[model samples]
Target chain A: MLLASLQDVTFGYGDVPCLEKANIEVHSGELIAVTGPNGASKSTLLKLAMQLLHPWEGKVTLSPTNTAGNKLVVAYVPQQIAAFNSGFPSQVTEFVRSGLHTQSSNWLRRLTPQAKQAADEAMQSMGVWELRNRRIGELSGGQKQRICIARALAMSPDLFILDEPTTGMDKESRKSFYTLMREQIDRHGKTVLIVTHNLSEMNDMLDRMITLERREEGGWKCCTTTLCSGHFAPAESLH
Target chain B: MLHYDFMQRAFCAGGIIALIASALGVYLLLRRQALMADMLSHVSLAGVAAGAYLRINPSITGFIVAIIGAIAVEYVRKAYKTYSELSVAIIMVGGLSVSIILMTMNKTINKSFSSYLFGSVVAVNQLELTMMLAAALIGALFFFLLRKPLYIISFDEESARTSGIPVQWISVGFSIITGMIVAAAMPIVGVLLVSSLIILPAALSVRIAPSFTSAILVSMGIGLTGTFTGLTASYELSTPPGGTIAFILLLFLVSGLCVRKIILLASKSTSKKMRPEIAVKESRISKNGLSSNLQKIRQR
Candidate 1:
């Protein structure tokens, strides 16, 4: 259901454009992984897709409505979010429950029973329920990452954009995390565009992979591939 | 103190600013904009100087200029995303420089400006009290209605934006609110010491509170206590309200931090005596700022 697409996008931090003429598309119910080497601007692609970053010269479009014809709900987990703001004074439950703030109909009203259940189920699935009462600052890196993912999970968004969501998790935890994402896509019909370096771990779960490669002329471009057979195509050609 | 009309106004003004500004401090501190209140106050001073020179109402001009400064800072902060503090410094320099030049040109206000500089809380008139009340009401409503989104943005703005919160509008609104509070608070603590009311309470509260909501409550509690105590001490000692209030808040911060350290140390020693292995692991987690492994060990 063409959830989001960035076509011929050009963006950069400084004078020189780092990502030029990059393109990618996300459809509803598809689990996609965006992978590239260090400095390949993988996160930039996701940011562009989410409208967090404006493209210097290209069209970046997100569906205003989901397949259900309601406002499209998106949840993004930026890289190293927990580590960057480690000293933030919030209980794990409080932090996770805040994800449902956007879903609540009234700003001042209490969380509905369903919303509260979603928050609890998210924490339980992520294995952070026991640490619900603990301060977020007190958690380890892996624990922090899990709770952050749990926060996004609680949102029950139509689209999930995650950047390196499994940075510090153990092998078993990472596998379970992938399984949960797969369930979100298959059972709930959610769309996911994840930025990851652990391509091998998520390869099986992902329907497609987008790799950012540096051009000889000095900017980056997106190369899309179907995960199972590795059938490659230029990002612009895919759509 | 309560018998005198001016004293009554001063206490009322001080109490209101303490509550609103302290809650604001929690958000500002969490957003890493601790210096924003200080910068806005300095910028508002430039407006005061200009108003005196032009024979306009200084408080009105100062309030307008503070709001302008906040909006300017928000725009500049966006440009210097990686160096957000640099935007604060740039605006501060511009503000202070203008103020000094304006003050030099307006000698008639030199003697009278001490009230605005060092803060003559006892001199708070009806107009200033009304302005403080208005700002406090607006601030209280802003914090209460937007508490949920504000929490998410404070933790991670990018994520909050993707989650459908209007991050830019909220960010600018937050700045405007900050400016209004800073300007309104000027009469009580003056420009120089206004930030102490906004930053000090939250600084201590963030350290000790268990959750985000508790942190705000704790900050307000400290601010109210500090302001009341400072006002009493200043009245009794015949000292400057601005300096006295700032000093009291600083004392609260230092004492709060000291008590927290003492408790942590006591816990460490007791844990070491009872479970040496767990104590060592706890220290390791504290040292490195990671605790998942410890949680795993506890679960096992």
Candidate 2:
């Protein structure tokens, strides 16, 4: 299923159009990576696809339902989100549990037994269970990153939109994270659209890759993108 | 103090505003709009000045104007998303300037302006008390019913949107609630010290509380304590109630910070002494490659 798409899109922060005439599509159950040089508006492209940003021209579509005819659940982890509110007064357990809030049908905002189970499972999976009682502000950078992903994991959404989710993680943690993401796709069939810089590390795991590049056009910097079949192509070949 | 009917009204008004304002402060502080209370109070002052000039009740006009100011700020905040505080500053200047001009137009208005500026215990009339009670009741219901979505949106509006939340509407509703509480609180704390009632307790609680819910509770506790004690002190020493309340809250904030710092330092030292090996291992983990190595081992 087509989860989300941006076609013939033109967007920019100011008067000059930086990302112009860009096209990208996200399919259900596929892990897609969006890579680009700095200032290429890669994050903008993701935002456009997610309908978080309206395009100056053309169309953006996000399917309202999943394959099973249920309301689509989406979890987004924006770039530098851990650093965004580092001083947010919350414990690790409490923060992770919040991801389940949308899933609750009642208006009471009470924690159900199922939500508790899901939260604990997500924390344990992300290795943040040991630090569940610790305040979120007190955690290390990588630890903070893990808990954030864990929070998203607890949501168990149909679509995951992540931007630089591994910024503070080490190589081993990154590797484990990839393995975990693979399990999420292969076992549970969740669609993920991620913006990443580590093309070499993520190349093998991606089903498709979208690359954004900028070229000078008529005295203005304009962006274009290339979509490639990921599993068969090497990361170096794209460059 | 309770012997007087006015004193009873004053305590009731103070307690109600303290709870709602402090609660609203947590959301405002987290959203990086702490100066909003100060800005709205100033804007409400302009409304008061206009009310007196027009031969209307200043409190009613002030309440309407504060809500309008809040909506205006919300729109302006969107225009300057990267520098949201600029909106507050811009609105504050407009509010203060208008109020000053209006106050100058009516020379006799200065007699009542001091009470609005500095606050008086007797300012909490039956009408003001009723307004405060209504605001508090509405504020409490709003907070309770929308707590979950508010938490998510407070963390990150963009992400909250993707999670299927109506971020825009909730944000506007939150602003309206803030305006109502700020306007209601003006009678008790006045324009100058109103924000102290909102910001100080939340400022301290956000630092010291272990979790978000606790932060709200702790702030309310601090606000109630400060309000009651300040009122008592004002009656005893013949001090202005608003200044006395603000001063007490300020003192609480200062002492809270000091106590928190000392406790953190003490805990660190004692932990190091109690578990030397664990401390050494932690340092080594920092020096070496990944803390995930320890995490990995712990996972096993």
Candidate 3:
């Protein structure tokens, strides 16, 4: 059930390394959180996992589930950046519907019955089903954020990744979001890795916590803290 | 004759360009690169001027230069990621300035330039029509085939790539495709007004349509409707086809905006009137223990 791993991963921007010598393994059906301080390359690490960025000095490999023909499916919902291009003209349902576009081959097909059911259930779970007909641009910050979560849910991927999706959400909303994530992990057996700064709120829900911090010697190093204790061991030592 | 050969040819070329431009416009508008069509058109204009100066086929030169300019826009956007609109500005200015230089150097280029600027549908030669058809073919191929990738990319590029989409290649391919369309559309709407075809219809469609697909389809409808109407008006009035088409599109855009505003205003007034009553009703329902928090006002 080892889904993916980044071996000796080192990545940087313009020659200056931010994440270095990082090795991480993702097992199936685990809820994990990647926690770090500012400038700790947390987002960069997510990029590597999602294959958006390549390791300058290492390898990233995904283990093919025997049933999946060497393909490891992943769905990522990025951090809620305020500067996102809001010019997109999709209703909430339509936005979620687009998430399935990546998984299927047939382009521009009408929302199949399955896609529609998935979208409905996802929106219902995310508590945005009522907003299905509303334009995405007309929604508030938190409402739009929920729509992002709904999009990823609609994908129903084997490995789900989220980057600080609750940045602007209120306390009640954040709690519900985490509960929903927990349900996805426990009931549905979906593997999830989230990059978040809200460790105080997330520690209880996470099965494994990966800590990335600037090393004393040079580039950043990562450690894994298992269970709800919020402890850390260097990745090398853990292995 | 109700249908002259020239009229038939012009409409044939114009209709295809209209559909392509409208579809491409939705993607650009969604990406907030609404001015991309305009920038590429200007770039094509410079190429046309250069070709006319050299006494070569301007359509060929326009396509090549526009593609190059489109690629340059991608690079410039990456370089200035925080200010992506800067690329459009750079291309627009650079293209116009280059055209000015080309015009000054070859005085006879003025006549050719006017034809490009105003667009004489009657003068769309067999060769030009053939070129437009080729561009349309390429445009349609990319537009339909890449629709899914383009949708996900425009929705959230980072997320799209995270989901294993080939974002860079598709984006570059899209740029080239739009460039081809702009080059093809230049002779129909004129280089200066070509972006209007890409932008106005999309802007209008998004306002009225409920989904991205419908928005695109609506945009194409607007493009076709506007093109045929403008073509007829131009033929009757003996006006420039490019100007007539652009003017018609502007009317559509203005009307769409007005409709959206009126709808917004009307909804606001109605909601304002209903708010207090709804709150009272909600409180009464809540006391009976069957109601959700209608006490909390939803933020739009």
Residue A214 of model 3 has an lDDT of: 62
Error of 2 at A47 (Å): 1.3
- By TM-score, how accurate is candidate 3? 0.85
Residue A229 alpha-carbon offset, candidate 3, angstroms: 5.7
Give one digit per residue, the lDDT tens place, for model 1 in A121-157.
9999999999999998899999999999999999999
On residues A88-190, what C-alpha lDDT tens digit does candidate 3 reach at each position? 6778887887778885464657778988899899999888999999888778888888888888999888888888888778888898888888888889878
Which candidate tops TM-score?
Answer: 2
CAPRI grade of model 3: medium
Q: What is the TM-score of chain B in candidate 1?
A: 0.91
Candidate models: Cα lDDT each: 0.90, 0.88, 0.82
Provide backbone clash counts, one per model.
1, 0, 0
Per-candidate TM equals 0.92, 0.93, 0.85
Q: Native contacts retained per candidate?
A: 0.84, 0.70, 0.73
Sort every candidate by TM-score, greatest first.
2, 1, 3
Model 1: CAPRI class: medium
Q: Predicted candidate 2: interface RMSD?
A: 1.4
Q: Considering every candidate listed, which one attains the maximal lDDT? A: 1
- Give the candidate order by descending lDDT: 1, 2, 3
Candidate 3's DockQ: 0.55
